[model samples]
Target: MSGLTGAQAADLTPIRTPAAPQASFVDWSGGYLGIEGSAGASFGAFNFHETRVGARAVPDFKTGDATGRSDRSRSATTAVGGLFGGYNWQTGPWVYGVEADLYGANLKRPVASTAQGLGYEGVDPAFSVIRAKTDVYGTLRGRFGYAFERALVYASFGLAGANARILATEPDLATGAVSAARRDLSYLGFTLGAGVQFAVTEHIALGLDYRYVDLGTSSRFDLGTLPGPAGGPLSTQAGFTSHQMMARLSWHPGGLTLPPEVDETAPHDPDNGDTGRFSLHGQTTFIAQGVPGFRAPYTGPASLIGNQVQSTTTATAFLGLKLFEGTELYYNPEFSQGFGLSRTLGVAGFVNGEAQKAGAPYPKLRSNRYFVRQTFGLGGETEDVPDGPNQVATRRDIERITVIAGKFALGDYFDGNVYAHDPRVDFMNWGIWSSGAYDFPANLPGFTQGVLVEYNRAAFAVRAAYTQVPKEPSNDVLDPRVFRRAGTTVEFEERHVLPFLDQPGKLRIGFFSNVGNTANYRDVVGLTQAGVFDDINDAAAATRAARRKTGFYLNLEQAVTADLGVFARFSNNDGRTESLSFTDIDRSISGGVSLKGSAWDRPADTVGLGTSMNELSPSHRAFFANGGIGLLIGDGRLNYAPERALEAYYALSLSKTLTLSFNYQLVVNPAYNKDRGPANFLGTRIHADF
Candidate 1:
């Protein structure tokens, strides 16, 4: 047997480097005994025929031809981990060795329907939310390899085992989600692979490899996102082999092996700074109507024959400047549209879910933003105005730089959300405000702590915002909704805590209030705002006009126990006579019990998670609770923007910068009410702050 040279001997030893935050603890060996670790992200989403925001204002029906293939994927996440050493015995000029990969991932796949049935195929508009989970907890790969001098050939026959927990794989047609509880399955996958590797130098090397891995099948988990065959027994015919043939390069200097004498000659600059950086990322989508998979009303309006191709898409760009240490000045711009499949003439397919129309494709959109990470912001925004029938209005926005200080801020800030709301001209919505405010720290002697005094003069200068509401589509197919609405808002609000009243784990006094003007609906062409499901008529628009309303909200809570609490809410409104008041204007009060708190008594060490684990917000973040309840009271903001719901929820922490929570919301005066009262159900979300 030939022994390795001095340099090769050093390379053969395990690197023992720390694993990358996003990589697995898998090692690669070279020349029969070389160990390796690589961290990179992967994109496994299958976007067969999806134009989320269409290309040229196209709608679903008018989108391209359907292939019935939905896309279920996860972007490759960068993983960090290292491998151990393994001996390679060479016989007949061939070498063999064994290797293992020890690593974990927080993988999830959110699968949704991309193609709803055409023209109301109506059999429960195929839908699903494949709460995808891909966790190959860890794998020990056994390998036998071959080596010919400097080059090596290898084969791996290993158990690609994983601890998996699948969610609504088989969804319910009625709900377009899962029916039963999660179907958890432990899978044993056999992965077969072969590759060629070469050592470029004593510290750098490269290789190429391929794999065919299979995790046996189980129940049908159709990620009904694509228009084609969702996952099932039929979809099973397609094997679980994701083929990849790539070239990779590696470098292992082993912590500056240069000797002390040579190090003295190296120059040094102990400064880490970037001149400035700019980045841009965006995706565009397009859809057209009157195509194969869409439906149009046959009798109603001949022009409404439903053969329109509406396309909607948006592209975003960002510019940033590192003004100093730990701070940046940023500017971002976006241009978006909502339809290309169906023409702006109100193609009914996307209007009523009965035939698969939820929210109308936005006729037009354009916006610009500029903000400083720890300072001031100056920017402008604009959008196409909505007109009656099939036309949209053109609106523009402008902002001047203000409040560029750190210690105290006495300037004003205006946040805006505007759109056509519908294909209605006069039925427009606009909100404007110029307000001043003062902020105080939570740790202060004066009663001013945690108190933000803000007073703004805002209202529809022209339309006088009675209330800007969102219009919901009468029906929803397989897509989530995108609302394009125009509304005017003028208001004043305040939030603060009571002095020294910080009774630990006890009653806490807080106050919040809001006041705004009422909206006028007579001019609204569709007689509905964007994202609303109001079904009246042009004639009813008059009566609904009698329904435009606005008001203020107040909430207070007190801790009763370590996990229990109590709270109350108040809605104050102003309408000429109770008769003209909208349903949300009613006044009622209710009280209920609440329970929520941190689950972990203290924090734990996560240094072993990955190399980049320290890239998060902080070393330790106290997990807090956001849960409360109040008896059925006056109707909440159930219109365009659903009210900040009052529900029973327990938010759990996942890490310093992430939280994994499961909440069960109790509907009070629910927004989109079903024949049955509000739904009491459990929902989950993972919150992460980058």
Candidate 2:
């Protein structure tokens, strides 16, 4: 469009190569996504025609004289910033691609005009003002470029659209009265730009572009003038044109590669494998949830009430180091704050897994995990492990022994269900994320000091762990006497490839036992019967002793299709003893399906729907019926029913490293009590990882 012929512009200019080529040039052919910041000025012309107005006149008002038309126009400048993504197809030296971007803008201007003695036979005086603003804009463009080694110069042209606000106000100078109208309009137009990019690395490029955009005029005549005899219908038209100078940074995931300058012959570091010697990653999650209204009989120590908003936030940094052959150390430092609904109480399956029971006004930082993992390959088939948080990309034997020790969550080692593991990116309910009744072992923040041993074969694996639990029920401090007061778990997992579905699936069964100072539900009942303050909670204090609680759970995850998977979990814990940690449920069953949005052209997006039913054992129910409270669930009195929960969520990938999700939950018979009603929770979450 700029006058150069297709032959001259799209074809790369021939240039002589170096006498002796050292390395191949950077490849610019690939899909790229990036964030960019831009500062620019938008020029806009707004024209307002005072065709007819119903307002009081100054000296006098004549209908015909007031109907006369008047026009005023003005223009101004603004700033903008946003995100863009594109893919390029390279044939030889020519690159062609399409890009899309959205930006926020602030381009506003005001125009005023005064007419003295002009309306009624040069006797009426009036003043008119118009304000115009452009709030948002986006573009879709096709770009063509020719590469010269590590640099590319390109031109782009695109369709553009914008949202604008127009306000027109007129005041009769003689009457001190005002008439005003406002209109919001969507305008469509075109844009053209040119830029040159220089590759800073094989995968990263920086560039600057100068773009010109023109948003065609939007006219509205339906905004009737303010109430008055001299005010009628008014017409307003606004147009915008802008020149932007934007600095852009682009990251090509497929283009990340090693530089060409490395030596041909160098000793390889054994510990690094293919992922290098050290890795660092971080993630931040923020969730806000609330219930609009729910039925409740009476509020107890732990009861969900109607109309409440609760939010939680967590940020974590993962650091990994390769220590020696088959050995690695990983540590995670985290900061968290805020509380779940009802201070993380009420429901057996409490919402907001990111929330801790003890929340502080300010962020609380803790060493969440520090562990050493050693793997011994037994000479067999291998599996590839991709680089991720706390993990180094590498290959390991399918038949191997893995030893892990230090501080970590027991969930990290056992009863892992693929459909609902990560609260930051998947399901947020506690019961669904892990086996609710298993109560594997953890301090207040859901971590423990432990050692784990795993033996893996081609299609089967066995794992066991011994960890320290809290010193007392629901306490945050771990018991120092790990051998005396500890938690142990064993699990077996079998992997299968289904014949008809041609998909992979896993079935895991686990058993867990925790020895700690805990109270017995029956003993609490007995104490209450013996006039121990007439409260079951008081009976719990009188019955505290060193006890063992045992539980078992079955977990299954089956991939039904390439983009669809289903998971189910069934767990039961001894109901005689009070819950030492985790939720109040003694028996639970949960299942769900997860689907990838590849069918809709959004492969990174995910949707999940799940339901869970939790029940309390007879003694546990009796305690609650006698006004007793466990860790999370309680009601003044109980008309017992299974705590049933249905959860659904849709997670949208904003970028490779950012995701946004909307979650909904429906809970019937919260806290296993029919008196307290069905509650609905709505939540929004944002997660970013790097």
Candidate 3:
């Protein structure tokens, strides 16, 4: 529960080693399933060779490190499983054989927490989670053969290569493993196979085969997260498929032989199909305060809720393609931005180029957002109509359509909150945005199924957007009784996702709005109130209002448990108003928790409601359970019309990327509040997700 400090053992001691044991594993031992059917059936020829084991899962560095997380299998076993074996030589219409193998990968770890801000003794709040293992043999593979066994089948060809090691472990208080990372990855492969086997006699036989593994290279990692340092884009090429139904009892004593020569090139057939894929992509954060030339005195106060700067670094590259068979083409790019981002105190400000530094007005911008999307659209499988083979309707599948435009900000098109992913709402990360999304497949789980229609099948999706605001004036209504002074505001969003009513996590009903056209500025006379700042700096000139906005959104992400999960969200906004009201508006409701076990993995919990409000989270008050709407005292602002207030926090899943928090916030500004004690109550955060 405590370890790593002395400046984190002199900032990670020249990369320490040997200290990986939170819970790790990876297994392999040759022979990845073999076959050779026919004994009491009606078909002959098969093969077998299978062996796997992948271990190196030493999580719980906290609770649920990051999200691609997976632990809990301490008994369900298989830490990214793998195994391989070789041999297959048949003879009849003709056949051949040859093989060899080994496999394993590095999950990675080297974190030391508690340094997000606010200060403490060498940073109170500790860290530790080790389990680093590295091993990767010749990683080589080979397969050669031929066969025309049944009435309609035969073909296989393969080539393989491997040598891997990418490990890191950081946890030290007394010679543990300060820091140690190793990298060396390589893999080249090709395979194509077709199925049809039916033999149940002299030996054994069964059917169903499909093989397509073109590990050409495309699955690189280094995330980097924020601005400069983590590393970018790396993914050779990937296409994996293995749906086999086997049963082979062969006694290769010298009866069926032939070992060499075979190359059935269907280069991944289906009209030369190669819809490549290899993903491991990656951000949001900020903590800058009072700008103008740095006054540096721990200046605290003057917040539009949050974003004392915060642009949160940046890096992303989500790529995957399969343009046919229901459609799929998703490519998201941002290449690189700031690695670990440090403009001194944190924050990039809403995101667009982040809190200007290297020369203002728009300094660093590297936006690469590409799109041609379809995950499932267009379906009708039954081909044959040259003259009258019957079964019409050729190729009419268009269930996926995505067009993304970016200068940035629509929550970067895809990554939390527009319809809400989890915390974030502009701060000078500024302008430009466009979006489109699609999802389908359902068969009455919650009483609705339509992705076209396949009886008992249901799944649906929708998203729309427009973004670019923040030229200034949104850090707390900017005074003037609070109505309109800042600039740039026009946002619209919508979402409808529902499935899994039996409950496990799946529900979304969304709506968000904003419309602020302010800039005629000039008001403050005779102190009708607003008193000093030296008498409102010479008050005069005030009305030119046209700030109309609207808002609504709700989400429920399910997966109650493979380990644990129970999520919920609710939002409300007035955007500034020309219409709709409950008093200018700002409402919230939240509750969260998630966890997986073994050493525990994938743990998350966000709780807030009662007009809930979140400020950069990791653990905002132990997953706060709803709170925040308004009216708590004098200077307080009861959200204007309706005045609601209740906030919450509760985060626990400490590992993979770390998060241990607890906070409770309730706000009102009739100007400043008239009652209540310690500002009303609870606060804490021990967060991280990298």
Best by lDDT: 2
lDDT string for model 2 (628-647, tens) is 98898777789999999999
How much does each candidate deviate from the true structure in C-alpha RMSD? Answer: 21.4, 17.3, 29.5
Q: Counting only residues 3 or more apart in sequence or on different chains, how many pairs clash (N, Cα, C under 3 Å) in candidate 1? A: 113
lDDT of 1 by residue, 1-690 (tens): 988899999988997988654311113234233333222211122222322312111122323335433344523221223333334444444556665554343446544332243332543433433344554433445666654323345787677655555443445344455443354556566767665554444454444433444555443332223232332221211112222222334454431111111122222222333122333322221211122222221221112222222222233344455455324454545433332222222210112111111122221222334444332223345222222111111121222221222111111121111111111100010000100000101011001101122222121211012111223111111111112221223333232333454322212112112121212222231334332424323322333222323334333444444444444433333322111201212232323453334334523211000000000001000000000000111111112112222323334443332333343333321222121132232333222221
Ranking by lDDT: 2, 1, 3
Off by over 4 Å in 3: 1-273, 277-291, 294-312, 317-324, 327-374, 379-396, 399-510, 513-572, 575-690
Off by over 4 Å in 2: 1-275
Model 1 TM-score, all chains together: 0.29
Cα distance off (Å), candidate 1, residue 264: 35
Output the number of the TM-score-best candidate.
Answer: 2
